[model samples]
Target: MTTHQLTEAQKKQWEEDGYLVIPSFFDKQETKEMLDEAKRLCDEFDVDGHPMTTFKTAADGEHVGDEYFLESGDKIRYFLEPTSLSPATPDTPSRLLVPPSQSINKIGHALAILNPVFRKHTLESDKIRSVAKSLGAQESPRVLQSMIICKQPRIGGVVPCHNDSTFLYTDPPSAIGAWVALEECTPENGCLSFLPGSHKLSRTATRFVRAPGGGTTFIDVPGVEPNEEKWDDMDGWREAPCSPGTLVLIHGSVMHRSPPNPSDKTRIIYTFHMIEGGKGVKYDEKNWLQPTEAMPFPVLF
Candidate 1:
């Protein structure tokens, strides 16, 4: 596979804005194949004995979890869009009935290890290593998680403002996300927005993990909460809408969010985060998602 490296100007922009947009990172053919693969996965997964437990967001906009949701941490599963369920009627038994055309929110967390197509694009590609080197990651970076975010038309849920390192955190916070657009993204279709220079402020404020009792929980960091005031200021933020094949590199500490889709178009994107796996950088064992013995995260050297 052909590899693309970051230019000096792009590296400078990343340093200043905590993000970099690489236009046409993938060709039209590649993007179309990826989108096709995503659609196939969403439509064909068999849930014979397993419960059809879809991911749901609470009223507070946090993810609601159960045993089924927690067990899917390292498995390929389909999560339904929050608004895809039909309301209960007098004849309907359950309130959450999957609509005729099922709206899937995402299919993720284990695609790189289980799916050959996704593995080729992620672990087998040299582009990830080249980008890591440009970001000054001396050691080989390891892929932590991979997910395809499907912002379905009209009913796509809003993702609240937050940094990625809070979820895929390592000691000293070396997480970075490579987000590839599989279709044209626009503000009307729930494209991502970023707070420039937010990474330089603080590494992380809180982390999301499985609680001792049950369900997912967000734990606060001891002495860090940078960008709270700046995050409140809306002027410094900007929307990053791009065409198909564009790749957006996100700094771990940068605050970013995407609004709900209000348009008829669907915004499909494949994203994954990488963390430095050097001797000194500690990947916390308590981070909720642990690597299985059969397939650990691939290292990109």
Candidate 2:
């Protein structure tokens, strides 16, 4: 295993900016393998009978069901772009067939566990362990979820500025996302834009989850209110464009967003989040997405 150690400057940057961009974190050969695996999964998974869940934004977004979303938590399933389907009432189902050209938005929470190549890169790589150490994580980090996000050409959806902990909440909010670009990511093709030092300013306000009865809802975190001001000010936000194999580390509380793809090319990326697995840190039981019975998220040491 090749260990990629972070320099002191890189560590300081992470502390100040709430994010770090490591150029060419993976070599050409490794990135090619990942891209190949992603393509294979996309081709193999049948979207016909699969539930047509779409990529939802934080504001003015529709809530998804537990059965439709959570059932595929630890399995390979395709989610469609929101623009592909027409709106429908609760009584009437509006699921549509995603065309082969722009069928998928993302596939998630299971690739690292199920695919050997992804597993090696995520769990066994020394690079990821070095990142955990740089963050001053007391215990080994546990990988919570993994997915491949595809920003399809011209029709991809916009992801609103939000924090990672809002989706995967721990008691003290310990999540950190490791995103690797499988293709060149440019502003034209929906590259990630982040608010500098936003992690220090905001606490987790609400989390996405399934209500006790049925469908999904955003419940408030105790003693926290949504901070509109943090996201409102775009002056400090910076775009982090990256080349293929670059890894972008995102702090859990940092506010980040990606625009819709209006360009002709697609932006493909592989990503996952890790949380501190020490005894004191507790993973919230009420979070909407949970590990499946067949394949639970694995610990990365």
CA lDDT for candidate 1: 0.78
- lDDT per residue for candidate 1 within 145-225, as digits (tens), equals 788888888888888777888887787788899999999999999999998987787658677777888777878767876
Q: What lDDT is reached at residue 12 by model 2?
A: 92
Give the total clashing residue pairs for model 2: 0
True-structure RMSD, every candidate? 2.6, 2.2
Question: Model 2 lDDT vs. the true structure?
Answer: 0.82
TM-scores for all candidates: the values are 0.90, 0.92
Clashes of each: 0, 0
lDDT of each: 0.78, 0.82
Clashing pairs in 2: none
List the candidate 1 regions with Cα displacement exceeding 4 Å: 45-52, 56-61, 87-101, 225-227, 230-232
- Stretch of 10 with least lDDT, candidate 2: 94-103
